[model samples]
Target: MYTMNRTATTEMEVTSIRLERDLKDRLKDLAGNQGYQALIRDVLWNYVQQKSGDYQPQLSPEEIRASVEATAQTEERCVLTGKLIRPQERMLLGLTKSGEMVPLSVESLAR
Candidate 1:
């Protein structure tokens, strides 16, 4: 998940590579469905991850929910209660220090 730093005036590397006609057409079709540049970046990133074995493991919905629950206590705060959340409560109904319920993101649950 590499994102460009907007605060820093850094120039990124840009390269032009040639692709076969068939491949290009297929990519273009996918690009039509997704975004051309985004699709290209995703493909390249996936390839790099595969080669380096740096890909993140896929989490099942249950595991994801559990992880979200476990991590909620660390940093996430209930939007309404302004209190830190806990694992036992549903994210949408998370308790704040004030005893209010709220929602949270999945990333906020990760260690």
Candidate 2:
């Protein structure tokens, strides 16, 4: 949910943290050309934004590849509208263009 600001890197402060060798290797593999350090920063920023209530996950209609009807087994928040979905409630699972599954209210896509 967080967008990276590549130009802001020059203002970043150096900080050191320890990581398990296996975890480091996995991050490296996942990061690929972007490099593990930049990926770590993105992961951390997303976590912080989500926890701070500043991150609102949303997708335009074009970004949603498909939607499937589903029943929520647990409470969920609609990614598009931020509406709360109760457990066992009928909902839609929107498959994003990037292949992420996100919760949606039944009326979210209603015409």
Candidate 3:
């Protein structure tokens, strides 16, 4: 998961990109106080991390606000345990505190 690094200072290079007016407006609305540019960066970073296989799935029950039963339409890795969930297997879509819906093994929620 991509987290905002508030204390870390890193050099940034400016780049220009064009977006549709409607999309820009939506991003602005979703970003709120964080700003759309930062949101875009976060989205991009998440994509890169996932594609690069650098994402470590580590989540606690406390970080999950709720969960919904689901069946995997495709293979997925549990965000809480890094367990492989095969296609058509029982799983869960956990609603995290950050508002992301992440895959979880069915047993991950067992208490």
- Identify the candidate with maximal TM-score: 3
Which candidate should be chosen as best, given lDDT against the real structure?
3
lDDT string, candidate 1, 1-111, tens digits: 222223322454667888888988888887786556667776777557535645443222222222223344444443323344455544543344444343554344445
Write model 3 residue lDDT over 1-111, tens digit each, in one string: 476575433577768899999999999999999889888988888777666767666688889999999999998888877787999999999999999999999999888
For residues 1-111, could you state the per-residue lDDT of candidate 2 as single tens digits? 555668566688989999999999999999999889988988888777655666666566678789999999997777777677889999999999898998899998877
lDDT for 30 (candidate 2): 92
RMSD to native for every prediction?
13.0, 2.7, 3.1
Specify the poorest-scoring 10-residue window by lDDT in model 2: 49-58
Off by over 4 Å in 1: 1-11, 59-111
TM-score result, candidate 1: 0.39
Q: Which of 1 and 2 is the better model by TM-score?
A: 2
Pitting candidate 2 against candidate 3, the one with the higher lDDT is 3
Clashes by residue pair, model 2 = none
Overall lDDT per candidate, in order of appearance: 0.48, 0.83, 0.85
Record all residue pairs in model 1 with backbone atoms less than 3 Å apart, i.e. clashing: 83-97
